[model samples]
Target: MTAIDWADYATGDKNAASRTLLMREFLRRAALWVDHLGGSERWPFFDIAERVDSSVRADPDLLERLDEFTNANVPEFIARRMCRAAVHWAELRESTEVTLPDLPDPYEPLIVLYERGGVFFVENGVADFEMRRVPLRTWQANLAPEPVVEIDQAVLDAANEEVH
Candidate 1:
């Protein structure tokens, strides 16, 4: 009854295909439920929300940090938090609902496409590694490009040398 099964569709236009967020949640939750309970998994999103919300609330200390930074615990600090919480990785991050990253340059349609769960350059036939997850804070449904080119390495080096 699910629209897109993570185990089924390896790649697709998530934005174009998905009608509701529940469908996305269903995929991850079903996979987890299948591994945990059995019955090959059934309706999942509704079942898992309670557990997920409870788990997230139990750690309110990080609520502000997660809300503000979109990164509850960066890779560098996650290990320490996991050890402190005595929880594994899946339990640590509440939602697989990935955060979107800011595009490198707005003008680059390729970057926009990549961020919107679409890719033209790299064929993601094997994985739906949503590139938007790269920059969680920069959330915008539409692409508005403002391009800025960084100075050349030589100029950067000269500036650095003067400061040093």
Candidate 2:
């Protein structure tokens, strides 16, 4: 799929633009996770959890951005799991040597992102729903053309209102 020019909406509809930017960030991270795991294959949430943990260690502020993405209430289960995994992993990392944290309950189902004929689709762990597809030129296209700024909650709220 062609990359969205989020900047075009900047002046006309700031809220929508911000929301799209957020989704772009979420998808970008998902694509990276898939690449890190060595091609698109069904992956348990735990694997993603470990990656999330390491990512947080490298960039402390990533947790906050993940939190913001989760709070935006995206409909995809994978999105929620990604944020939840990050939180779970971070708590585990905080455990002291004397008192190790208990293992978190396992995440149900499995998610995967695969490519065919140069297009990508996400196999959302649910059987009832069909796989979700997003066409793009390449994995690198998932990255935003420019830096994505932090979106204000009020802007999200306004965008949600417009949608309703």
Candidate 3:
């Protein structure tokens, strides 16, 4: 499908007819975008275009319908993004404050600390062997030791030989 230059709609006279046409166009584009993403199932996003089309055909007071839709408290973000408009939207009715669930910290498991002398430390098991050490004893003691595993010397030597 050909892309319509939405900027064209923004130009010209700012009358009721023009506004209605622009709103209808925006709703159509939003419906197409919704269909492109996935057909409406849980949410009836695509139905917006049909409803707006009906309103346009009926030549009703779009501003009143828009106010009603806005008062219903649908997400403004989705409309703003899909409609390609820079206009500020106002809600006619006051909306209740939404309480978001507290999110858990992703880095909670790792211990982060600074030594008294100013050396920083991380207590996670993972370590970089190539880390530079100014004080050898303190660094060695703090780093978790690699577990020893028994292996036949001859078999190990043969495996290393194959890799080389």
Q: RMSD per prediction, one decimal?
A: 19.1, 13.8, 28.2
Q: What is the C-alpha lDDT of each candidate?
A: 0.28, 0.38, 0.25
lDDT of 1 by residue, 1-164 (tens): 01112132223334422211212222332344334333332232123323334343335564444433423322223212322332222242434553213222111221222233322111222122333222111112112232222223443334334533
Residue clash pairs of candidate 1: 100-135, 101-135, 106-145
**Predictions ranked by TM-score, top down?**
2, 1, 3
**Model 1, TM vs. native:** 0.21
How well does candidate 2 score on lDDT at residue 140?
49
Per-residue lDDT value at 1 in model 1: 9
Error of 2 at 56 (Å): 13
Give the higher-lDDT candidate: 1 or 2.
Answer: 2
The candidate that wins on lDDT is 2
Q: Report the poorest 10 consecutive residues by lDDT, candidate 1.
A: 134-143
Give the alpha carbon lDDT tens digit for every residue of 80-145 in model 2.
555456455445466443232232222211111100011112444221112222233344455433
| Candidates 2 and 3, the one with greater TM-score | 2
